[model samples]
Target: MTVALMWEARAVAGRGEELLAWARDQGLSVRPLRRETFRAPGDRVLVITWWDAAYDAELPELPEPEGELVTRPVHRWRFESVEQGA
Candidate 1:
């Protein structure tokens, strides 16, 4: 099965660039099949990582950034791929 992990965070004030950079620099203990980073108008950064594992399997995820860098705690979610319609 394919699992995708999502990590999202909102940076403080005008530190979006710094937050994006920080997120991009983060490394996982075990590399995923694919990883991507995104940013939005609200200084929000989102990272998605795809892995080859079971839905309930233990997996590595991005850690929280320093308190001062963000306005609130990060949000995360996990989803397993479903069959595509033909």
Candidate 2:
């Protein structure tokens, strides 16, 4: 099964773009099979990375952005793929 890491954060007031840009430049120690970033309505950013490992496997993750750029701490989640379609 393939595992995926989902990270999310909200910018402080009007720092959404800056936060997104910062995230874009960050790199993970383990390259992902696929990665994507998204913007939500309320200055929220979501990043998803697909990796070729089990959900419990150890993996490198993007570091937290500088505290000043975010309203709160980043949230992270992991999941194992049970179905996929192309």
Candidate 3:
């Protein structure tokens, strides 16, 4: 089964671009199969990385951005792929 890691954060008032740039420059210890980034209406940025490891396996994670750039701590989630016709 495939697994994916989702990391999301809301930037401070007008720091959306700055936060997104920071996330873009960050690197992971374990390389992912693919990665995607998105921006939302409320200065929010979302990053999803596809991984080869299982959901329970140890994986690298993105660190939180500077305090001044974000309104709160980052939110993270892990999901495992489910068979469509099972």
| Candidate whose lDDT is highest | 1
What pairs collide in candidate 3?
Answer: none
Over 2-84, each residue of candidate 1 has an lDDT whose tens digit, in order, gives: 99999999999899999999999999999999999999998999999999999999999999997699999999999999975
Clashes, model 3 = 0
- TM-scores of the candidates are 0.94, 0.93, 0.92
lDDT of 2 by residue, 16-84 (tens): 998889888888887899999999977899999999987799988888887589888999999999998
How many angstroms is residue 66 displaced in model 1 relative to the true structure, after the best TM-score fit?
Answer: 1.1
Task: Give per-model CA RMSD.
Answer: 1.5, 1.1, 2.2
Q: Which residue pairs clash within candidate 2?
A: none
In order, the Cα lDDT scores of the candidates are 0.96, 0.89, 0.90
lDDT of 2 at 62: 80
Instruction: Report the alpha-carbon TM-score of model 1 versus the true structure.
Output: 0.94
Q: Candidate 3, TM-score vs. the true structure?
A: 0.92
Q: Model 2, residue 83: displacement in angstroms? A: 0.9
